[model samples]
Target: MKKKITVILKKNLVNLGSVGSIVKVSSGYAFNYLIPYNFAQLATVGRVRHYNMFLSIKQKKLNEIQSKLQIISQKLNKITKISVKKKIGNNNQIFGSVSDKEIILNLFDITGEKLDKKHLYFPDIKKIGIYNLDITLASDIKLNIKLQILPAFI
Candidate 1:
């Protein structure tokens, strides 16, 4: 029976393993491909301990980020509606469409949380009364906000 060598992955490899993961592979494959390319390292006791420590630190940081996102989500949920003013045309249609930038700025004004416009999911508002906006806070957290468009007299 051939003995498999234990290795710790240094980076994520598709179909292989993730970073900091301990896996066993054939010694030839480990030495030729994984180790030579800096993809993995020999999993000695000390290296394993260090990897475990690194994983713990990473998990701690992830938890902190998640908690902060949760707080932001709570604040965003408190906002029930956002009002936007645009010039009305002859047929009650907005002259300019509402875009993600406008929504992001309004959210920052109301909630005091600065969010990337990429996180907002909405269709272009040409003629708007009440529209639903989906804001992705995290993979697991989403916020729904109502958008109200009022006619501006200029």
Candidate 2:
């Protein structure tokens, strides 16, 4: 039986491993592609120790970020509904549809935190009474808010 060669990855490789990870691969593949591309190096005792330390630090930072996002999500959940006034026509149809930009602005006003409009998920709000919007704060964190469309006061 051939022994697998262990390597420490210097960069993230698809289907291989993440950065700072130790993985075992065929010697031919490691020497031909990974080593040549500077994506990984041989897993030495010192390198393995360093990788473990690096992973611990990375995990700590991730936990801090997750905690901060969790606090923001809690604050966002406190908001029951975001009221947006729009011009209404004869049949109670709004003149214009709500956009992500507008929603982000309103969210900032309510939460005092600015969020990227790209993270908001909602359908086309042409004529809305009340709709739910999903806000992705992080890959694992999400918050839902109610959007209340009200008729504009003339």
Candidate 3:
């Protein structure tokens, strides 16, 4: 039976792992095909340390982004309600339904934070009244806020 050896892949291979992934393969395959083609490197102690350092730096950057998003979520939740004005047409219906883009813009105006459409959840708003909005900033940060729709001063 052939011996198995460990390697760190430099590129994605079919039926194999992606780049930066450590995997085990036959010794002959590692020496003849993978290493010669510059597709992978043996997981020496120094190279393993380098990979760990890279992951550490990546984790730090991710933490910083999450903290910023948490702050923005807190700011959004502190407000009791937000008011939006629209021209009340016949039957007290808006010209059209309020969309996610409009809500994101209003939040940006209030909190100075840009919001993505995928993270904001609410019902299709047509008639002007009060409704609830749900915002997800990160995996752990969520917000529920009141939204008040009123007639525009014209």
Best by TM-score: 1
> Which parts of model 3 are misplaced by more than 4 Å?
10-19, 29-39
Best by lDDT: 1
At residue 143, candidate 1 shows an lDDT of 87
Q: In model 2, which runs have C-alpha deviations exceeding 4 angstroms?
A: 1-5, 10-19, 24-34, 37-39
Clashing pairs in 1: none
State the lDDT of candidate 1 residue by residue for 12-63, as single tens digits. Answer: 9997888878999999999989999999999999999988898899999999
Q: Residue 122's C-alpha lDDT in candidate 1? A: 84
Instruction: Give the alpha-carbon lDDT of every model.
Output: 0.90, 0.87, 0.89
Sort by lDDT, top down from the best? 1, 3, 2
Clashes of each: 0, 0, 0
Candidate 1: list runs displaced more than 4 Å: none
Clashing pairs in 3: none
Compute each candidate's TM-score over C-alphas: 0.88, 0.77, 0.78
TM-score of 1: 0.88
After superposition on all C-alphas, the RMSD of every candidate to the true structure, in Å, is 2.1, 3.2, 3.0
Relative to the true structure, candidate 3 has a C-alpha RMSD (angstroms) of: 3.0
- lDDT tens digits, residue span 1-154, model 2: 3467999989999999788778999998889899999999999899899888988998999999889889888889899889888888877788879888888889889899888887899888778499988989898888888899889969
